[model samples]
Target: MKKTRFHNKYKLIILGVIILLTGCFGLIYFFYRQSPARGEESGDMVAGVSAGALSNTSFIKTYHLRDTTHGYGLFPTKDGGYLVTGDTIAGGGMAAPYPYIVKTDAKGGKVWSRDFSSQSGALGYLSNRHLGRLAVETSDGSFVTASDVIDFVDENLKEIYGDVLLTKLNKNGAQLWSLMLGDHNIDRPRQIWALPNGEVMLLARFLKTGYSSEITDGIPEYSVFIKIDKNGKVQFSKKMEWNATGAERLVDGGFIVLANIAVILPKPAENIVGPEVVPHPLPTMIKLDSDLNIVWAKSMEMIPTEMNSPTSYAGGVMTVGKTIIREAGGDFRVIQAAPDGGFVAFGYDNLILTQGMSSGGAINISDKDVSLRPLVAVKVGANGNYQWAKKLTVNLVSGGSANDFHVVRTADGNFVIMKDVAHDALGVLAAASAVNIGLIKTDADLNPLWVKQYSVERSVEGYGLWPTVDKGVVVAGSMQTTKMHYVMGTSEPYTEAALIKVDVNGDVGGCAAVTTHTGATLEDQSSYLVMQDMKVMGSENLTLKINKKVKEKVNNAKSAARDICKYKKSNVTPIYSLLTSSDGSSPTASGQTVVPSTAKTWAVINYENAKEVAVVGEKNQVIHAELLPILNQVYNSQVKMKDSMASMWLAYVFPRPVTRADVEVIQKNLEGLGYKITGSEGGDLWVSKIGLTLHLEFAIQNSMMGKLEVRF
Candidate 1:
């Protein structure tokens, strides 16, 4: 009887212990659901966390000033700010798009916003699209934008006619002048360059005759180059044969234009049915003299038709004396001036296929189901001779392909390419199609250094990229969000302008691991193409009209467009697992390295290889207390620290180039905080308080770049 009683007591004790353990796990899971860890889902952590906060310079933000907004171009200003050009549409049925521009400070804070359609009387019409693809800052600190505005619309809300519009604004966002050029046809601006003589050069695609849809044999297009003065006067206008896509100003005051020409292939590629010959579009580069005369022209060759792998040709064999035909469409999209006085062009190659005659003498073309496409990069010398070509093949796991791409050379002599990859719901098992931005950094030889993919939103398209002084990059684009349309009584996708600033490692606070791509294969195909001379037409001056301007009230509220639009910060950080060497081997170490506590310390450690010194007393706490107030006043600036065995000093880096006006403002702000200027020297000022001393120094790197450094 006593043994039975003891057994019952032990069973009760075990039951109580199990219940306690179960309750503890339940509470732990409940708290985890409330506040999950970073990089668990979207890889986003809330800002301002003291434990693992991001650097003050890194940010990912979306701005919605209207119902729908799209960012097309981004340019850095001399004042360390940025200018964004895009279009915005109202929240109504069949609303027309208006050219929009926004200027922001270095920290991505909006300074001023303008909608040209609301200001100009010429733009007060319902149209289909108004696309502003390029903007640049002039030597005088003014801004200029080139846009294609469809001003005429039919009764069915269809676009009828389009014109090229050039608008200039002062540094304060005030309109200086506006001009429109058209010939009663579609005239789209392709590129604009600011000259050193306060003049601007514009390249446009002009439809000379015939409707774009009705042209079947050849595209009835002409390349128009116009030189305009600062006062909005057209100095000269030159016309060329084909449609121009890109242009770059040579160092010797000349220019190089990238255009497309029709080329007819030889022999068995001809159609067997008719006497008509299909002309394939080929990219050609034309160099122009300062007087608008053609110097030389070079056409890029097609990718070779032969492949080492048998499956690439779909098991078909080439007949004797028969050659494979090049694809019908291929064009270079971007042309950038290289450091070696030459130019680098980037584009995609056409798909491969072979044409032959069947047993019945009919045309038979065998094509393979290619899931990958090669992105081509070509380099040419200053004399317009081909230097080298590299091909990159990207395997899209989302079953999509690359869309738009931009390439820029970094300060470190590397090239960074930003490309958009489209993702379909059928392949990704999502609700809709989306686009993710991909960044690939390559060495001087076009070998891949690293590749990363960033999904900022469900659908995002990057159109502009600029490298920063800190070796990082900023990407500006448009992201889509779902919004309820009151009139349509349904939800529709809305667009907002997105700007992302990442560190040198392409990190945005938190990142997750993803699949990596091998290095891009490089092949030397420089001997395939030859340069020839092309014809250049005469130059003429065209008339320009000034449009009326009306100032609109700037809205600064973040929730102003809440009802009609949505803004989203990026939740996912890009992965950098694809870092590789020139020999296509993975690196043993990860691409990321732990940076020092401050920027000055990091620079010292990297450049000087200095050892770290620990703080002796409560000096760090005292320094933080004294510096927090000053930092709060100049919250937009970046702060770095210099630590030594004796003392620690804080350095404040101004966001904009330092001017007398900026210095005076800082002095006033500091004086309000109990600091007084004690002495002054050439481009240097000293301020002091009861126990603190501050030094302000203005240094100029070049005629165009300057910086302000503050030490205390």
Candidate 2:
């Protein structure tokens, strides 16, 4: 009987080995078929259509782990599998969310899922009450996780901030031990890097308990480096003054830290106004030795000679414009260590004001819209000197925020960037424009090759991206499921952890992770104007007529332009005590504070239209002053006509699809406004206003912008 049992065990062992070998071979063959040949040019897309890059790549499979699971980190294991760690909010009699770990096969099928929520029996001691921020596989096949847990009350009866917890688990997902490292305040890790020497390094922020002292009044946070051994034992902790946002390991065993510094500049003395304060933002780069000691630091400066080059060191500071550079926003958020020992970083550049507008010397005029901010890429040399920069312009209707948070490099020396974007073109309001994942494939030189987007019915934000051995990509993020309807009682939260796997060409194999269609359609541009047209029109023209006595002071009508424009030219006389707006708001105060009357040589025109008034001061103030009122009348007349006509056109064309009922309403409104309903074509309605033929293409989608065209 003993010999028979032993023989059966041997047969089972041999059968298991055969099954493993066959699975490995299948994976190898599958990957071989998916990958492109070496030296092949990457696929390109023109006008929202891909050439061949995505044609072959299709979604093979997708795995939804749980109801509420956030996958933050993914790693390929040695056995053609993957390990992912995040947090899960489970449903039970007493529900408590905790960090979770999952193992999957090469085909994205779940092998095992583990929730590390076990706690100690001691009172007030909470275990596994944290979310895993990062994880990596160790040499011995075990995993090390860096998670953060918040403690509302400590053992000492004081409020303790969140602490970083390090846990070690075996290959089967069983916990070996856990170590929590934090005291007095918050110690949050921004990034974790597994060193080649079997050690882990964490770039963290150490927020001190109290505010800054008198000497360092402006600095409040500290950037820190915490190193630990494989056994979860602390090696050393080093800290610096600046607060770091992103970091990466360098080829020379050093590290590069990216941060922004605020430099306070002295106000100009000649203006003789109150003590003005100017804050200049300096995108700074700091190099640190392997031991966590600062090696050298470089900051942006405005040296007058080199400001011409946008990528030059001096170009970092805009010295010629306004006293403060608040309108345009830029921040370096993530950095990637280049193969050539250099570094590439991505962020955004927001231009708030147009060029011709005056912004300095007390009167600030800026555009309120910030949706035009473009994604920016900055490249630096090995020594941290600025080399070059590129701006990725997004011309979406009513622009939205597009930011690249993570990046990965391909085997062909190209790069794949991952971003989460929200824009007006995607939806109507901010709530409807829940962020979507955006991907951009670029060449080795950082030039964009193709762009793609992914989203579901709700918002999805991708936080981590990894390149697989098969040349495919894996992305992990959080997804929210919004409630379509609400009731008087019951609570429903809409947050889920999501993972998406795309082929080497970025196609989701027929899954719900739909490709985002962007770029504005014509209909999106015209909806709101039509709605306004349906409302009652109140004809009110409040114009400011300059006194006849002031016009007599000007030498000629042409000189009046100088008074409205060249207020500082010294030859123009000051004009004050003009009629303010009906609500008593000063016409000169266009969102900016009034320039002190003590600077009497400068006079502001109280006209309704700034664009129509040609500002001319000492050189031609006399003529400008005369033209200001006449130009205001002409501007007022045009605006009033457009407002009245907008309603008539909208009443005829809206609730569109050019239905028979809508056409009757439109024709009646047009006739009331003294316009002729000329013709129709394939359900499109056409009207004649004055000498212009207006074509109202109907069947408009409500969530889009308004659109209108003139038929020549």
Candidate 3:
């Protein structure tokens, strides 16, 4: 019996071993078969080629075209597809780019694609091209496209300038008629408005060098209007003394032109340039007759709010500067005729110029301030007088300069604006601009209802937007990607054409788009937590009065408050949330719990955090003498010094360790602040005997400030 039991046990062991080996082999085969499928799935999602139903994911649909393709404009077709226009750089970045257009179905499927390179030139022979701001679908279902032949000179070859290039294409993407309209001088159309009567009006600007005295001399830009019939033949042309930026036809058979006229300030008494007084650019509105005769021109005053004026510098960040006054003007970028017959002009305003170091190692102060470009709106009556103008005070995600590129009047009578923004509001990114695109919806009076921002890793520029047939919005822009090649020690930037369609409610398909609005939590509503009333404990934290709803939610909440605190100057971070009951009951300190970030209602932010190490003046310079005037003059810029402080920090952040070149600017500025360098180490330095030490350290390839201890 024992021998039989041992034999059975041995058979059982052998059977288990066989099953384990078979299972292992099966698992390996399964994973091997699925590898390719997983890789392809990731490629489809990033390539934006999935036939994901438009009705399914409505939040946002991103499309990535071929290498070095840019999308400049988008227009929705009657069949629920979209028509996009942009330039394509084939061959490589060094090759000339050609205008490319695509027609995509509602589901973002490519219906057809056409590249104008073939018509411009043969292969290997590159041809440079520029698409007009947009291509519109004409009343006859065809497309009307315009471009500026750039860098082209006249027969005499005096100067290179852009000439108007127009092309009409049929439904099948075949060119029907191509024409070049301009004199021997520069002529370019900035915008085009398609009329209901099958006619198109071109809002063009021309060089003033060859025109009459009225159109030339003091005026550098002349507003040129050309009306063309369906045959693309000019019916009439008119010119006037206006720096036309944008325009729209009125319902009364007339036109309202949005322009930026130079406000010529009288020459300062110190310098007598009587007739050559420089003009400051300001937003102006001009009403023209059907014959294109200027009836009345109205230039608006600065924003009435105290913060909008320079005198309010001590009160708010919206104020530019007390002494850095430039022209309080903005160029009308986008204009739309309101439903009530009035016209709305949207642009940047309250500009101030500052003096700074130029690349040529020379100090050049700009004629206009580079720090502030508050987007403003001016409402003009039917008769061309200003009704009301106000700043669109919607808090931006990244504080920076923003310009509106497109505006459309929604079916609900509100206005939608598409703008491009950069991250550095302080002009610290050198000359490179553009980071993201923002969409703002405002009422008829220009009050912001809500704002939405869309961004990728790199810069995204919003160029054009149109109302879709489904009452949604179709946006056209460009998305860029970068790749670094270590072998070549170089970086290559590749741009792709991007298109996004949002439903009528500002929702992307079925996904609700994230917006820069106060998401009031249930606790906030029950307790009436007004953000403005939040007590500021210091620069980093704030105290909020917790009600019953907040108390109960805090005990069960996951993490602390993580939403943004929207302020007038900028939207800022809210680092932590410390909750306390109204009855003075404090919750037990426990482990940090994960909380829903979206449910956060409180935000704490500080706007005046200095980017540079603010230097201080000597005791004698502060006690009996004022330092602001001295610092302001020595800095030769907009520097506001208090009674005790004599310095402003530089904008560059210390990365890794500070280098000698980096510390040189700081040392020079400190010397300007009356600080004498008393000691120095490899990369560390000390000034005077005031106990100020700047310790520095170095890594493999970079340096950073190790410690900055200041005792004053």
Candidate 4:
């Protein structure tokens, strides 16, 4: 509290992390060496989660507040319902309740909400509170970009220059037109692309001054790309001295410059500093435009200062385990910029300070600040021009820490990555950094056929992705630790905010049996766990309990959950069942099918997974048989899952013989429940009994890696 670093929550860390990942999540992952099958966290909040490819099901969107602002925005509202924006700082800095925005209706209530002119506090005016990074809906329904920072004395606090400011609501919040964009510097506003022809694209960043004659390029670095139309009018403004963390909007019209392009270089002649630091070549990009006039631009040069520059851009899994920073790690090799601009990146080569050993014994590498690891995704080919080049080799390996992952593109098209992973947990048990949300499924020559892993505890830099209209993958970030419960609190270490839901071949989390993108509503809260995925949704898993042994298991199930179970708030109920097999292709998010009869037994219970007395649900819901055996460890992944249910395994129940009376009835019921066996030999016995056809043969053998064969 006396330090001044990344702040907290935006407001809190992932105390168990959000019910999980308050930010960019993928809580539905699978690896299967063994050990997993835990569910049960019923705080309620589900209306219709289960969509696309075959997992068809929808309807979910109920939680209204608690702390939100990762730059929220999600279109479709001439008025029918839904516009949501973020930043509501609670009772803190800036002014009083700003960045808000609202407009709900498919069912979040509030058909009107606003803040911008400058209230600062609740969610506006910026400075601590939140919200800034573009938000749009304009074309008349009014809703422009750049908010937060409603107060400041001198240099104006620079909120992307605090105010390209524009507000013009109608569905109810009312305001018709309020402008203020560009007076001197700070035009921050990031990402807000929408040009089916209406043209709006604006991925801005301009703090301008110089670059550092000491503290001047205005002190923000550089990154700009504007093109207005919905009434603000800017037309063009393409700049890039090297400093843009993100920029999307390219279904094709143009605009995709995930930034960093400032390679000043030329500092060190000698002066190595203390704890090992050698970096200063930050310039990673993927530019392409037409209006601002940059037909193409692709930079990514390294080997230069201040310890690795291509900073910021992390995906879910909650990172910060400290790889030495430089954006944890990098293996980015995204190509497609060849018209004479030339681009062929195959990057990989970043360690930035290694040296390990922890668990109290000391000597933990110290930390040069930004952390490090990157460089593993190499394989380039470009022709737009040339400049962002790389090629290096030299590593002896002392504690490992390299593969800095996050290069998504999955749900069938191929390419899915998100790893803040750390392997080698074998010996006296030391090297730990377990936050891996990898669902790799490459093809089109991108190689890698199947690689799935999901073990998040904390340390995922920051992200909140969303691209599921019907392909799969609806990630949101924020975590410090989580088992996904909407009112179960704990990670008070950083604060709290986590939200997860992964399904679209990413392999199970919530909503995905094939409807593509329907019903994605996570909404948990104590500190926070929000999700609204209503691009086309439904399913009411909308909890409100505040945790107390889950209101003593809902005052023992029913009886109106102990009269609305108190704890500031409580009221949850929304459960569905669907599973497909026998040729329905591969549907699960509740398609609920069976009837082939070999005994045709299919069950499913939801608990958000992990190892909570209720890890993976519905095999016999006496609340899932009061689950617990380390939550039925199969293949043993310790934990991580959002709501589990699977089916089929009868290869004759599996090789059989673990005999010796199945290790004497699990060593006399885990020594009459004291549980600490260590191993009296004999294994294979994880039967919490999952179904929906073993969750569709574990999502079609994790979407094809095993070749796809699920027939119970």
User: By TM-score, who's the top model here?
Assistant: 1
| Candidate 4 lDDT, 507-578, residue by residue in tens | 443322211111111110101101111111111121111101100000010000000111111122212222
lDDT: the better of candidates 1 and 3: 1
Measured against the true structure, the TM-scores of the candidates, in listed sequence, are 0.59, 0.55, 0.53, 0.22
The alpha-carbon lDDT assigned to residue 125 of candidate 4 equals 44
- Pairs that collide, model 1: none
lDDT of 3 by residue, 1-712 (tens): 6544543443354334334333332332232222111010000001111122222213233344444666777777777677777666545444565555676666655666655422223211112222254566777777776555442223333234445655666777766665555543456666676766566777666665542223334466575667766777776666665656677777776777666666545543321112222134455666767766567766543211110112221322222221212223334577788767767777653321111111111222221112222355666556654444444333343222333367888755667777654442324342134456767665565544455666543566667787654445667777654432222344666566667765544545223224443211001111111101111111111111110110000011011111111111112221112222222333222222212122111110000111233334554234213333433433343332211233322122221233465355555666676677765555454665354333322111221111222223
The TM-score between candidate 3 and the true structure equals 0.53
The lDDT of each candidate is 0.53, 0.45, 0.45, 0.32
Give the poorly placed runs of model 4, Cα more than 4 Å off: 1-102, 106-163, 168-171, 183-186, 190-204, 207-277, 281-712
lDDT of 1: 0.53
Candidate 2 deviant stretches above 4 angstroms: 1-67, 78-80, 90-96, 117-132, 156-160, 210-218, 262-281, 300-329, 352-369, 395-404, 422-426, 430-433, 481-494, 510-712
lDDT (tens digit, per residue) of candidate 2 on 93-208: 12444555666665555666665432321111133222236777776677777665553224332234555556666777676666665543455656776765567776666566
Q: Is candidate 1 or candidate 3 better by TM-score?
A: 1
Show model 1 residue runs off by greater than 4 Å.
Answer: 1-56, 92-94, 118-131, 152-159, 210-219, 263-278, 303-330, 351-369, 395-403, 423-432, 482-487, 511-712
Task: Order the candidate numbers by TM-score, best to worst.
Answer: 1, 2, 3, 4
